[model samples]
Structure formats: C-alpha cells, structure tokens
Target: MKIEHPAPMQWQFSRRAEQLQSSVIREILKVTMRPEITSFAGGLPSPATFPVERMREAFDAVLSRQGSVALQYGPSDGYAPLREWVADHLSTDGVRILPEQVLMTSGSQQALDLLAKVLIDQGSKVLVETPSYLGALQAFSVYEPEFVSVPTDDGGLLPETVAPIAQGARLLYALPNFQNPTGRTLSVERRLALVETCARLGLPLIEDDPYGALSYRGEPLPKMLGMNPHGVIYMGSFSKVLTPGIRLGYVVAPVPLVRKLEQAKQAADLHTSQLTQMVVHEVVKDGFLTQHIPTIRALYADRCQVMLSAMDEFFPKSATWTRPEGGMFIWVTLPKHIDSMKLLEEAIAQHVAFVPGTSFYANVPETNTLRLSFVTVPPERIRDGVEKLGRLIAAKA
Candidate 1:
C-alpha cells in the first residue's frame, strides 16, 4: 500500500479561536520551573501538606472493596456518595443543600469552563472583581463575554459596584474568601450587603471558594449561597485541602442550572474520573480532614508570617502589600514608575519570580501591581526572594 502526500492547506479558525489568549501567569510559571529560581509566581499549595499515605490507603481500600465501580464510568452529575458528602459538608445552619444540586467536576477550572459554556454568550456582560482570578478571566473570555470589573478594597468587592453593572449582567463571579492574586476576604458586613443588593438587583452570583478551607483561623464567614440560595452558584474544590493531583471539584447551584451544567459536562469529558472520586470519598468520609486540615492551616499561617515579615524588612516604603489571614498569596503594589512585568525579568535574573497583576484585569490593567505566593517557598528562601525583589523595585523607583 502506498500513501499519497498532499499539499498543506490553510486552516481557518473561528472568531472564538481568535479571542483565545494565553495565561500570562502560566507562561511565567513555565520559566520559574528551573531549579535555581525561588518562585512566588504560581498559586501552588505546599507539597508538604498532601496526605500521601492516606490517599494511598484510600486507593487500596477502594480497589479491594469496589474495584469494578472504581474503574468504571460515572454519572456526569458525579458519584452519589461524594455528592452527598459535599452537600452535607457545605450545608450550614439555615441553608439546606441537597445532593442533587452538587455536580462533581475535574477541578474548579472545569467548573468555570462548564459554567461559562452554559451561562455565557457572545457579547454577554460578565461582572468580575478588580484583579480577579486570571484563570476565571481566561475561561470566561473564550465565550466572548464583555467583562466588567467591579472596584474592590481590602474587604473585596463593594456592594455599590454591583448595582450599576448588574442590570444586564449574566453573573457576578467573586472569590469571597482569601481571594486569588489578592488575598482579601469579603467582610461579613459586605457579604450581607452584597448578597442583598444582588438579590434585589436580580443578578446571579457565582461564588468561587477554593481557598475557604485554608483559612488559618478556621473561622468561616457567611456564604452567599447560604444567604440567597436561589441566586448564588457555589463552587468548591478539594485541591487545596487534599491534593490537586486527584483533580476533584464540585459546584452547588439551583437544580435547573445544574442540569444544564451536567449536559455541558457530558459533552466536555463525560464525567470526572471515577477511580479518583471513589478514592477521595474513601479518604475524606472517615473524618480525616477534620484533623488534617488544621495542620495545613498552621503550616500556611507560619509561611504567610515569614513572607510578611520579610516584606516589611526588605521592601521599600513605597511598596505596599496585603496582609492576608490565610490563603497562598499576597498582592503587592509597587511605585507607579515601576512595572511589575519589568520587575519580574530582573527578579528572575536574581533567582526570584512572581506573577505580574496585569494579567488579572479584564480591562484597564494596573501595571505596577503583582502577586506573590508564600505557601510553597520556605522562610529563608522567601526572605531572600523578597529582598531581591525589593532591591529591584528600589532601583527602578
């Protein structure tokens, strides 16, 4: 048999393909993978916190007890026992969540993608927080939604910001607890006001809470989903608490919306991996997270303090940053004369790297801002990295 070779033809791409943009943070993270770099670029959880032994045991137990089910395909809605566990875990005093409302996803990233697939359309208005999660922006942008970023403070998005933008918006996406890029948590008072305002405005809220479990104080605030169950769509993940390798995340929304998301998910990847789902359920169903999570909290808290102290001692007076109670990151604002992207080049040359905040903006980016993740770097290295970054900033200033 002879195979004939044909001339290469020009490929035409869709408008959506033209709209697709690369993740700037991820691009920088690739450069930081070198062993010599002390990186604060990626929002990576500490490897020391993974429950390796427990996961191994869970894998063994699942293989021994229900090998066939573990390896077989699962419902797009998710594993029943896992869904029940999610509902029970997130259900609070007055807010009742049912297992049917929970849909398991490959990760929170997939949840964002699925939500965008179902909820977003061409030229749809999507509200986002100023300096929001870059991944969310990337996921939503592919659908060609007009992103409007609401102004934020240390307490997160202001309620007043929602009123003007809420009229024709499809959804308001926010990270209320230890927000990514900027480690600001939404205040309890602000949460109440924002939820009330959105409810009154008839705007849907997409609350992404991947880092809620990592709070150092272990004091959880009122969730928007709990406040206005009908209006808020909640997303949660085990990536931070357990491990990212399993790639498990879940979403709790109104049933009708969940059904639509299920359909979208079915087309995407059929369902999340059954083996990982069963293994995770086996690991957490035993109440292991109760004791295990506190250890992670303590470790992260210590690391956060180290980074803060280092910043205080080494950074210039013109350089300001957030003091977070929990989560993996700290947001910094350098002098107006300095650009974070330029600083990153110099920092990487000095064996240090961080993500510039330009990528997080949906519009009108502030170039002087940057994000530094503290959880993965050790105290001594964090001190050195901060010092090097500070020196670079001072020189630029």
Candidate 2:
C-alpha cells in the first residue's frame, strides 16, 4: 500500500566542512564524566568560587528595573553601560581605553571566531606558539589559515625568533598571562619587546587573556596592549572569576578593527545576550570583582600547592613539570619512551585522567607530555590521583 522511492544518496559538502575536526580535549571529557574518575582534563573553573546568591540578586534587580529592555533586542556592539564598565576596568595610568573600542562577546571564544572572520583569508599565514590553546587552534583552523608554530619557553613567546617566522603572517595569537596548558606568564621585559617588534613588523597581535585575573600573587603585570595599543587586540572574560554560565567577555581594539568585528558579529549572532550583559553589569557595577578575584586566587593557590607536593613525593626524578606562580594547569614532560595518549588508557583504567600534550599543538606533537589541572579536584583526591598516575609511569619507565 506504500509507494517505494529511490534510496537517499550521501549529501555533498564543501571542502571546508570536510576539514572540520573534533576537539581532542572535548572527546576526552566524555570519558572523564564518570564519577569514579579523577579528571584533570578540562579547563573548568571551580564551582565553589561562583557567586550564586549575588548573581541571583543581580538577576532579580535587572528584572525589577529594566525588564522590558533586558528582554528585547540590542545593538550588535553591545549594551553601552557594560561596554563602558569594561573600558574603565582595563584603563591604566598610561593607557586609556575608550568605550567605543570595546566590543562585548558571548565569551572570549566568540572573540577568537570574530577575529578569524575579519582577519583570515583562505591559506593566509597565521603565527602561533609551538604548543598553544586548543580552542584557539580549533577556531582558527576553520578559516583554513596556514599555521606557523613559533618556539616557546618558560618565559612564554620568544620575541627574537618571532621576526623570522612571522614574515608574511596575518597575525600572531598569544596568551601572555597564565597561558593555558603551560601556566606561564610572560615577563614584563619580554612583553614590551614582543609588542615593539610586532609593531615594527606590522603584524597584528591577538592577546587572549582569560586567566590573567587569577594570578596567585596580589600583583598583576602590565598588559601588552598598554605598550602598543594600536597593534594589539586584547581579550578578557568574566568566566574565570565569576561564572562561565553567563557567557560574558569583551575585546578592546582600535576603532577601525572594532567596526569590522561588529559587522562580523552582526552576521554571527546579531549580538551577545542583552539580559546576560545587563545582569553581569548589575552584579559588578559597584566593583564586586575587586573583592571576589582575590578569594579565587587564594583557593587556587592552595590547590596548586597540594598537587605540586604530591608530584614531588610520588613522581620520579626524571619526570619534569612547570611550577606556575598562578593559573590552573601543570605541564608534565614524562620520560622519552612514554606516550601520554597511551598512558591515559592506563590512567583511566585506574580511575584517573589528564589531557595529552599532543592535543595543544598545531602540527608535530610531543607524545611524552601531558597537562594536569589542579583547581577542580580536592586535596585528598588530587593526592590519590597523582600517586596512581606516578606509579603507572614508574612501572612503564
């Protein structure tokens, strides 16, 4: 009684769609979701630091005061007061941030995507660190840019080597403060040199700094943008200190670039959420971050210390890891013979997990390296996980 039709054929797709690949960390996170596993895989902020009651108060206040406007459509650039707040917060003695130069985004990730849209063309050369943020690599790859990985050390990006590799490059993407996966902060001198060199070379610098505010030490370093405002696009986010749920971040750049980014943003999502922006503004209008950020610093420092001590006691002498002053991760380089990807299989069997270093690179990867996140796991659990991981490595070695 039913009419038969020809079988459906495979849908044709663009070449760009064919090149899209899944994030390795995202795939690893699925296995780590089990309660039994002690996961050091995700770059997630500790939930204990989230100001739940304060955010609730802000939401209620927004609804009570500007309910109609908060729910309606807004400008592609962002809400004015929120943009002004971002500008004021970032301005320093020598550097002045104009509100017109600030563009609010859904998150710092959206800023990366927007920059890629405006700056990258097919086969355009883009410079990056030898090992960089996986999320940035994923976002930039969609644009089909030819990536050139510049060598890095504990001090962060090498300014001297930059000039040689950066020729014919569209931009150099860097996370100078509390860098993801590495947890290293660039020295003030190096930052100044890098900024100066980039300015001279006419290469744009995109500074993605989400974890800069989470420094364990009370002191903060001068931003690279402060050195060369016209040459750099600085990105910041409310995700680390507050909560990622609100999905709030902003980019400060020169007026001309901001105009192009706004156009790209218009096509992306029209605008970031108006309600979220208004609520975040209400929550932090009276300088809430000034008090809130220090507490996060203290908590993370204690957790980091716990993980460091555990590594010292349990791990072998041959295994080396970075001792970060502040930030969420610890990079461990195991013995030359061991591959972290294979080690992860054993670690998961023993109910522990970490991100392999291979996922953070643009091209050839170091299989012996891995990244450990200390903030989310409790002290006792961290001790347990590190000990188990050390024993596995010791056996393999």
Candidate 3:
C-alpha cells in the first residue's frame, strides 16, 4: 500500500532576515571574473603585495614548534601575544592602550557586526556619513536601527553640523583617515573638534581606520581614539598590509565594552581560528609590516596617478573626480544628467566595470557618483578602463 506524504513546511524567517540584501560590489565582482574585463569593482588589495613566502614560513614554524597549542581551542578574547602586540602598536605618547582592552575578530567586518549586536536595538538612532561604507550599512541594517546621514565635503564630515542631529543618536561612525568610498581624510582640526563635541555631549564615537597606514607621504595622522579612549571605539585590520585570506582584525575599546563584545562574539562563533592567529602573530612579531607597508604605498600611489591622468584626458569637462593622497579608490562625480547605475550596464558591455554610488548610501543616494579602484589593475590597464568609462559618460552627458 502506498502512503500519502504531507506537503513540505514553509520556512518562517525572522524580521532580521527580511532586512538582508546581497552586496552589490560582490555581485558585480562575479561579472568581472571574466579575463576580458578590466574591473575596478572590488576593494581587493593587489595580490603582488601579499607576503606568500613569509606566510608559508610562519605556518611551517607554528606547526613544527608548537603544533598542539597552535591547533587547540583558545580563549574567546584572542591569542595573548597578538593582543599585546595590538595594544603596543596602537599606543601613543598622548594615550596608552592596555592588552586587556583588545578583542580579536575574524576580520574588521565581524567587529562591525559585533558592535551592532551589542549597541543597537529596534529604532535606535545611528549617525553615518552622507555616503558611508556599504559594508557598515549592511551590518547595521540587520539590527534594525534608524540611520541618519551626516553632511560631508572633501575635508570629510562636518563637526559643527553633528551636534544638532546627534541628540538621540546611539553612536557616530566615521572613517577619519582615507575613507572607503570617497578616499577623503578628515583634517586634524576637525578631528579634535568632533572628538570634543562627542565627549561633551556624552555620545559614543566609532572610529574605523582600515586605510590609515596607506598614506603616500608616509606621514601618519593622529587617531580619534587617542583623544578620548573611553569615548571612542577603534577598529583596525591586517588585511590591507598582509593577506586577507588569514581573516585577522582587531578592536580596541574600554575594558567593559571589550568584555561585552567578547561575550557577544562567543555566542556567535565561539572563537576565531587558533591556527590562523598563531601564524599571523608569528609573521608580524618581528617588525615585518614596518618594511612591507611602504612598498604598497609607492605602488598604489603610482597607479592612482595613472588613473587620474587618464580621467583628465578622457572624461568630459563636466565630470569631476577626487585626487586622493592615498588609498585604492577615487570617487567620481559625473554630470547631473548621468546615472552611474545605468552607466555601469553600458560600461560592462565595453569590458570595463566600477561600483555605482547608490549602494554606498544609508538613505538618499546620488546616482551620478561612482567609485573606482586602481590598485588591483596594472597602470596600462588602469588607463584603458578609465578611458572606456570616460567615453560612456561623455555619451550620456
């Protein structure tokens, strides 16, 4: 006798699941995987800069010297020596950081998610730059907070304008050094004022500085965390300098907040990979990045110049773009009549690609803006891709 089977149950998802959306940059990267496309859509560091030989040596050393410890389960907070290194690395003459305040994350991206889980609630007000980092917006969206866009210019976020709208905000997130989408750096004067303003108002500030060390001039800027360590939460990463495959990044915060984040992280992933942490500590323990980072600065600076020159020669007179002192991206603003989203379709057809500015916004988006990454592409290819994009914009303008 044949038995009748019941229909499969429809899955019920939480309200948080409803807020999920795929990353537009990651989606565009799929199309650019073809060898014929000269793509500037991903924020990937140049593979030429990765320390492959050093990493292989470090992995071999870790497994040979301390195989059991390297492979065993470690503390939820992180490896001890790595935490101490992060503390000492970030400490300055004006401010001191303790090892107890550091928490290791899978990457800085995971740190963003941990912060959202610890700080955000339904309808909590969060402030961000007018066109903020897309990853941050995506991470915070899952927690269901209301985002308010703060006005900005080439100099970066306006300090005076922050106080008026910051009344009920939970936190003010800013990338004061070589921001992600715009590559704009906040001036030292503005940094002081913004930190003082937040400190006076009793509001917390989140300082994300993944690109701070990439300055072309080799001059480092003062971080806001040094100004008010108790009030600001600082996030840093090794992805830009080392390789991203190891997936190592860190957070330095007040000890109390660090403990809270550690608890949240435990509930999420229990702990980061033990073997990866040991290998990274082994690689960076002896001042490897001191010599390595300058080479990256020089290479990126050269590529940036090549792309800028190509844009000047090829783009229409109505088009304008930022001349970044450092970092991988240059933000472009086309004529008001042109929409970069539509322009991207025409561009991909011509074997060139870029990220549209719409995904970078928290609320309202500027359709005429787009971001171009120059580090992964060679200098000659940079010129060709920029020229192709320029022709597309000129036709629309």
Candidate 4:
C-alpha cells in the first residue's frame, strides 16, 4: 500500500465521460425529499399508477414457469415474445410491425444512450427542441455533439422552423407527444411534415414517445414509425403505463440501424434484464394492458385538471404556463428578471419544489422558465403545491 507507481499511473479516464450533464430532476428530488416539501419536480408517474399488486402476481407466475430462462443471460436483441407483444400492441389502423424490428432496453434512457453511441462522433451536429427532455440531453451529451435547439410553441416544434436547421444535422431528436418539460404535443400534420423533411434532409429522427400511451385527450395520432418506418427510431416505454420501477423500454428502428443498436447494446450492457422481459411478457399475454392502461390515463387526466384549476386560481398574472392535454409536466415562464433557479431556494423554504427550466436546453437558457410535474401527487396536494408556488412568486414581486 505504501508503494505508489511513479506519477500515480496518470489516472486514466475517457474524455466522453467527463462531459455528461447531471439531471436537474435528480437535484430537485433531493430538495423535495425533505418531509416538509411537496414535490412538483420529478416527471414521475403516480404511485397509484403502479399496478404493483398485480405485478407481484405476474412476477411470481413468470418466475415459476420460466425460472431458468428468467435468471439466465439472454440475447441483446430482447426477448422474442416480449418484442412480439410490443409490436402487436403498437399496431393500429392498418399499420403493423414485426418483432424483429424491436430492441429492448433498460429504459428508453438506454435507447437514447445507444443512439448517441451509434450515430454521434465528437462535434457531430445534433438538433433538439428548445425545451427538450433533460434526460435525453444528458444521454446524448456524453458523445460531445454540437447541439442546436429548434424553436417550439404550444403546437409543439415548428416543422418549418426546424426544416431549415435540419439541413446540416446528423440526427433530429424529439418527444412529439406531451413533450417533457414543455408538455406540448405536435399536430398530426406537423408530425408528417417532420418525418418527410427529415427524410429529405437525410437527418435520422429519434422519435421518443414515452407519454403517447398516457395521452388523455383527442383521438390518437398515427406514429412517425407508422408513417415512415425506414426513417425514424420510435422509442417506447412501459414506465408510463405499467411501473417505472421495472425499467422496461424498447426501440423500433430500420433493419440496418437496429443491428447497429443491438451491437451497441451488447457492448454497453450485454442485454436488458431477461427476468423483467419475462415478467412483462407474462403481464401482456392475457390482455392485461387493455385493462391496466386506461386506469393510468383517467387518474392522470383528473390530476391534470386539478393542476390547471390550481394554476388559474393561484398563479400571478405575470406568469404563464402551457395548458397541456396530457402527460406529467407543465412548463411555466415568469416575468423577465425572475430566475427559477434562484427562486427555488425560497420555493423550498415554502415547502414546494419544481425544476429550473434551463436544464432542458441544448444551448442558451431562459432564466424565467420552470417545469412542474402533476403526475405523482394527489389532486388536492397539486392544488396546495401550486398555491404555495404562487405565494412564493408574489413574495419575490
């Protein structure tokens, strides 16, 4: 122990690992964990949403029936039956996909990681929404790509605005339905335009949709993959509908890219958990999702209504936020000179927590912006939480 190598062996480390950005949600979670605090910070599904009781039953059944397979190392591509189940569940209208197209992941987060590994080189140009998923930004940042933010509005990303920017980008990443942080969904017409434009520009699209199944308003829009299978990597997750604790998600990409992602997954994590896949396959086998998902949607819809009502009643006239139809988060922008990060200390003193919005951006950040999550808390607490945030703002004024 006393003997040390000359110069301490120079302390080897990868340059890529140094550039990774920590998630703002995590920091906010720490602040919210105090017993006095009410968290509107994490993009979490409600504990009420987790079908934990049934999943215990499902897990037991899976373990009993396929004990060896459940515990053993498995193929990187994913469990065949689980892939088949996902493809079948995604099938709608006249569109369909085969199981061969699916690649299971630890979570959709892993899909973002694999995409970054396969597609990005240092200094590659990447396009993202002005207010994007912080997790996606963090995952992709490790590769050290130059990023550009495309402007967005309540209608979601402006297709025309991004088309010009797409001219030089290697990949265009978006969370089209109930987008994280902003809570804006793209119009169907705009979604088609995005697919077509990206195809024309040769910029592969990573269409991240963890919230699509949770949408509580309007008829479902056809997915980008359903429209143009060859051009988009459509990522899906069970975390929103089932339970996030299981960490099951998947991606469907074109054959060539799917192979590359599979290899990358093997290199990165060997494979996603087979036990979880077996559990998921067992749960989905008997049409449990048909009964399960609607419960999540209805509960979230009621929570969303509670948030809107609370915002209307309590927020300052100078503050404005999105009126989202579905999903966990709502984006808020304060009057100029108000910094959400700075306000967070006072907000925590008031026992309410929300994420500062700068964390979502690829470049320049808006000091006025913030993100709030309504999915995890009770409807009454959402009312109380937003009211407290309003009081916090008024005190600053």
List clash counts for every candidate, in order: 0, 0, 0, 0
- Mind giving the per-residue lDDT tens digits that candidate 3 earns over 114-208? 99999999899999998899999999999999999999998889999999999989999999987889989999999999999999998889999
Order of models, best lDDT first = 3, 2, 1, 4
Q: Model 4's lDDT to the true fold?
A: 0.87
Model 1 reaches what TM-score against the true structure? 0.98
Worst 10 residues of 1 by lDDT: 1-10
Backbone clash total, candidate 3: 0
Kindly give the stretch of ten consecutive residues in candidate 3 with the minimal lDDT sum.
1-10
| Candidate 1 residue lDDT tens string, 7-125 | 78888999889878788887888999999999999898899999999999999999999999999998899999999999999888898899999999999999999999999999999
Kindly report which residue stretches of model 4 are placed more than 4 angstroms away from their true locations once superposed.
1-12
